[model samples]
Target: MMNNKKPEVWLRGELPGISTLLQPAAHALLQSKEEVFKYTEGFPEFLLWKRPAGRASVGFHLQHITGVLDRMLTYAEEQQLSEKQFEYLRNEGAEIPEIKIDHLTQAFTEKVAQAIDIFKNTAEEKLTQKRTVGRKQLPSSLIGLYFHAAEHSQRHIGQMLVTISVLRNQNN
Candidate 1:
């Protein structure tokens, strides 16, 4: 007989207990994986869809999600993002140049790994620090960064999925 065990859900809907500072990061990391899987599943070959009418391909969007996570991680660490990162957001492409589908997937994976490490290693005191993005500023608490990363990925993942569907239909 085949084993039929189901995968356990990785995140909780309710807020974490007051004692845990890293829970938000943990939650966001899980959500990121879900988003990545949703966007990339069914047709890996479809990642090649770069529309003449659109800005970037599905691969570029994948790279962008990781790129934004890296920015949020910088904010979590109380470090201002560099001009290069700002340029990436404004320009809308890979921060790490010459990115292919494999490279984007790797970058996204690395971002998640870094996120987990930061959450695990950071002191509670550091989590309460302030972070700024140009004129807008917010506390660097785990919740803030966690929601930021997750919500940002959610928005982009939706875009990518829709784009993938359109591209797949167009190509066929």
Candidate 2:
């Protein structure tokens, strides 16, 4: 029997220029990018909007992964939503017929790239700086926000994988 697990990203080594304080978040982001595409590959396009037992559609999970990363990383910057970012947030799971899986994945990949840039430049001292979240003005530190971003992204990735497994298995 073959052992199929790939080595975890954190074990692979240090990421150069990414702040040591932000290392775990960087690893999580890189790992998230890999696992998301693996689970979503060749997922039936016809069922992109289909949900099992009224759970979120695969498309929504895909979109949410990207949108949440964008929003959370923005908050980590001590910023509020931009008009366009707000617009994206407002439509997190709305089903649009013409959108394809690649579009969502592409958006997510781009967001991860931007997030890495943010991680690279964030000062070590700023990890403890306070920031606000959402319109509710909930308080969080820079490190808290980064931790949440990593966890939240993985949370949605788990949801996406479960949804994909359900859908794909049903098809098979």
- Output the number of the TM-score-best candidate: 2
Each prediction's TM-score against the native?
0.70, 0.93
Worst 10 residues of 2 by lDDT: 86-95
Write down the worst ten-residue block by lDDT for model 1: 10-19
lDDT of 2 by residue, 1-172 (tens): 9998888889889999988889999999888998878888888889999989899988998888888888888898778899999888778788898899999889889999999998988889989999999899998998988888888888888998899999888999
TM-score of model 2 (CA atoms): 0.93
lDDT of each: 0.66, 0.88
lDDT of 1 by residue, 7-122 (tens): 42343453343227566556656666666765676655534547436656676678678878888877766677798887776755533445556666677888887776766666
TM-score of 1: 0.70
Candidate 1 global lDDT = 0.66
Predicted structure with the largest lDDT when compared to the true one = 2
